[model samples]
Target: MDILQILILAIVQGAAELLPVSSSAHVIVAEKLMGLDPTAPAMTLLLVMLHTGTMFAVIAYFWRNWVETYFKSPHERRTNLIGIVTATVATGIVGLTLQYLIKHIVANGDPHFEIEQLFGNSKLMAAALAAGGVLIILSSRIKERSGVELSLKSSTLIGAVQGLCLPFRGFSRSGATISTGLVLGVSRRRAEEFSFALAVVLTPAVVAKELYRLVKHQGIAPGASFPSLIHMAAPGLLGMVFSFIAGLAALRWLSSWLESGKWYLFGGYCLVASLIVLWVN
Candidate 1:
């Protein structure tokens, strides 16, 4: 890919990754439009950098807020920690179960089958995107009640929604989890905080998996020069800088829309994006 393509993807990944709209969908769409294969080794390396950039952005943006919210008191911290754990457990159960079903039933027990096999299916991605849009729209319409604290049940439901997002590439994890929180009467601020907290926990695992998968795909010998690996990953550093900047900006935009009750606009955008994905394919 050229410098222009890298810049485009960086902006897209940075902005969309933190937004309620699906970042993966946006990135894939941009890559497809540029005739780039996401699974290609170079692209895989780029993706890792992009994810790393966004993860850093999340920490930078949310650190202060998390400190105030989660670390205000020992008891409060413990309670919130338990909620996080519960949600994570729920996400693991649902995500793993879906993968198992897809591998066994959909793939006819093929040991080599990965859920990624269906990722390139345009129809499925569009359907998932459309479904997510509807969910976001409906959740946005529900009046947010202030002082409505998040409960374990609500957190569990949100986690389950996150799990559901795992296999569907176009379904936004932040979108689904935040929407579930709203549906359960969580305030916009709390929902946003919790959703991102879950993200911080889940992202490391995803990054590791992507790294392992891409390394295997690259088929590099154990004795390969470290600089050679760095060189391959270097094209993405510029993207990382852009993605990080974009993530901070996107988070502000997302907070504005969500706080101002304009979140339905994201859903509207997702619906249009879904159509575009289907149409282009």
Candidate 2:
């Protein structure tokens, strides 16, 4: 990708990565609009790099709260740390298990990434978008009914949604997890905090897996000759920096909007956008 493309992708990555909209869906759509093949191994690597950038943004933005909540009291810290770890492990297990089941069993050992294939599959995308949108809209509507706070069960449920999200692009991990949290009785602010914390920890491992795949494939030769990793690096890094700043800003806006319980707005957007994707594709 050229610098201009990188910038466009970076902004989209930054905004959508944290937004209730599916970042992967937006990115894949952008790639298609640019006439780029989403299945290219080199492109996969670049995509992971973009995720890495946003991961940093999550960590940087949430550092103080994480440190305070997770590292201040010895006992409380240990407990919260274990809770986070437990939830993360649960998410990983679900994600990896689903990935294996699909790759080894359902796909008959095919190594294809599901998102790359299904993203442009308008029917599937529409279904997932509609399903996720319904769930999010319903969850937002129910948040006030059950006024309970967050706990381990809610966290695990959110993490499980995150895990399930790994195999599907339009599913929107954050959207699902946050919705899961809300439906399970977690407050909006706490749900956002936990959702992002889980993302911060999980993104690196996901990136590493994609990177290893890229290296094994060797030489970026797909629809177009692969750009040098070095060339890709600059854009990825620049994307990360830009994303971090944008994420900080988005966080502020999200906090207030989240309190207003306007999550259904995003659901409506997804529903409409899904239709648009169907029409375009």
TM-score, prediction 2: 0.87
lDDT of 2 by residue, 139-184 (tens): 8888454557566776677777888888777787778888888887
* Residue range 1-281, candidate 1, lDDT tens digits: 88899889999998988898888888888898899988887898787788888989999999999999999999889999999999999999999999998888989999888787898888898888888899899999999888888998988999999999999988998899999999999999999999999998998889888878876776455677999877777788988998999999999999999999899998999899999999888
Candidate 2 lowest-lDDT run of ten: 219-228
Measured by TM-score, the strongest candidate is 1
TM-score of each: 0.97, 0.87
What are the runs in model 2 whose C-alpha is more than 4 Å off? 109-120, 144-149, 220-229
Off by over 4 Å in 1: none
- Residue 243, candidate 1: C-alpha displacement in angstroms: 0.6
Give candidate 1's error at residue 4 in angstroms. 1.6
- The clash count of every prediction, one per candidate, is 0, 0
lDDT of each: 0.90, 0.75
